[model samples]
Target: MALRTRAVLVHRRTELDELLDRHATRGQAEFFLRTRGRTLADVESRHEAAVSARRAVAASVPSDWALAEVERADLDRFLFAPEDVVLVVGQDGLVANAAKYLDRQLVVGVDPEPGTNLGVLVRHDADAVAGIIAALTNPPGRAGAAPSAVRCDELTMVRARLDDGQELRAVNELFLGHASHQSARYVLTVDGTAERQSSSGLIVSTGTGATGWSASIAHDRGGRRLPGPTEQALAWFVREAWPSPATGATLTEGMLGDDGELVVTVQSDRLVVFGDGMEGDRLEVSWGQEVRIGVAERRLRLV
Candidate 1:
């Protein structure tokens, strides 16, 4: 027997609802719709779409919980693990990832597009998940790869060392910026020496979040650089010479670490750091406080 069973995971994009069938309970489907100024019928249509898609992938788990307004952290509460090897179907959000990382969890990825998980770090593809399952039940080599299986293409899934000698694996990305919005006066230090933060932010990413925030920071780079290119990690800095985009409560920078650990630096008059936007002990980011990131010695994945 294998150490653990393999599983498959899917994510909910706005269009995920459309992929579902009728008579399916609306599972967080409307939340994916980004269309602004929608109509009543439009809202109903979105709900219908989400329900349909969910049905195609998952059997509805009847529940009386307050509507589809569930938060991302609780996305996986519905799916029933009837078997050792299960497939999680939903959009590419916290819920989907949460299941993959949970105890006794294995991940297999599926998407409408063949290479949908291209830029992102997938735990496993449908084929990989299936193969592991098959290897457990049947034999090896004969088993095929899962449909959602796609190779991850990132640059830096690095292990960065901060001045404190604390090394963290940045599976997605990492960076530092203003702790508070009040005219963030930051000094950048790369490799060891100090630099300058002319802009309002800084960012680092793993292969997972390269497309999200890193793509935004590099937006001015004319897209020459794709997502990630460094298994050792490459860094970027954003310094707004004049004024910041907004004031108080603005996300000055973001750091995407391994295992979906997101570090966002928000600055108003106070410099605060958040873990995946979750509140924590507030601290100020000074030019002296050491900060660093990279890949971790322990690597965890699903699929």
Candidate 2:
């Protein structure tokens, strides 16, 4: 049987929702914000706008298509099917948060607050969602023809896989570090070069992520040029590599071209590997385990 189309609406809780949850009432939330010289009306307006955008997107789904609503906090528990049409209604970070959990689903990024958010990922305005969905679902060709080829940008992604088979993917960057602020000890190998090092951590960022955390690190370390969003290469950095008799910092940073891989042999008791800054959803490796980081074969199909 042919697969049924399902529209998965992804969203994050609004600031007002969070405040109400914490304060237990609207009046209490108002009082809490007022003590900080902030007004509840502003938060309420933004919250209403976000909620309205989400409802609009949800309403835009074709009547025959199955629909599912998922909060960002519950993404790990959500099962995304291959035939699902994912709609992320929020800022770019929310898009990044959903990208790792998806495999081949096409994502429509809806910016509720267009002018306020940096919409690098969430490119479409909320109002455009209805037409976008109609165009994607039912192209203008034949009476019962298949949908036309989707026009999408294949955004590169980074992946970290351990010898034990646990893995994580991120549209931005993968962070390999100690759970705490303590330095992480590991054997770092990149492009056939290996070194024992002690440092804060390591970051392998995709071109999409080159504009964020990795870029800041590169700028602080004498301005190493990074790649663009659609580039196939990845920029990596070893943060604060402490030099000592047993460890070296010479292999500080480099680029991973197509087919290149970075390997890390855990030397500490336990270290973590998390993507896109989601520390809670991570892989932990103990001493003697090896981790491989590279460009993920799966890319985020941003529509």
Q: How close is every model to the real structure, measured as TM-score?
A: 0.49, 0.94
**Per-residue lDDT tens digits of candidate 2, residues 1-303?**
456678899999999989988999999999999999999999999998898888889889888888999999999999998778899999989999999998878899998776676477988877788887787753333222224554788899999999989889999999998999489999999778899999999999998898899989998999998877778889999999999999999999999987999999999988999988889888989999999998898989888
Model 2: residues >4 Å from true position, as ranges? 138-150
**Candidate 1, residues 72-190: lDDT per residue as tens digits?**
34443645332233344443443223432333333433332334442233333333433444333312332222334333222234443444454433344443445543345444433
Candidate 2 RMSD to the correct structure: 2.7
lDDT of 1 at 6: 25
Q: Which stretches of candidate 1 lie over 4 Å from their true place?
A: 1-37, 52-71, 75-88, 95-106, 110-172, 179-182, 196-198, 222-230, 241-270, 273-288, 298-303
Indicate the worst ten consecutive residues by lDDT in candidate 1: 60-69
Cα lDDT, model 2, residue 45: 93
User: CA lDDT of each candidate?
Assistant: 0.39, 0.88
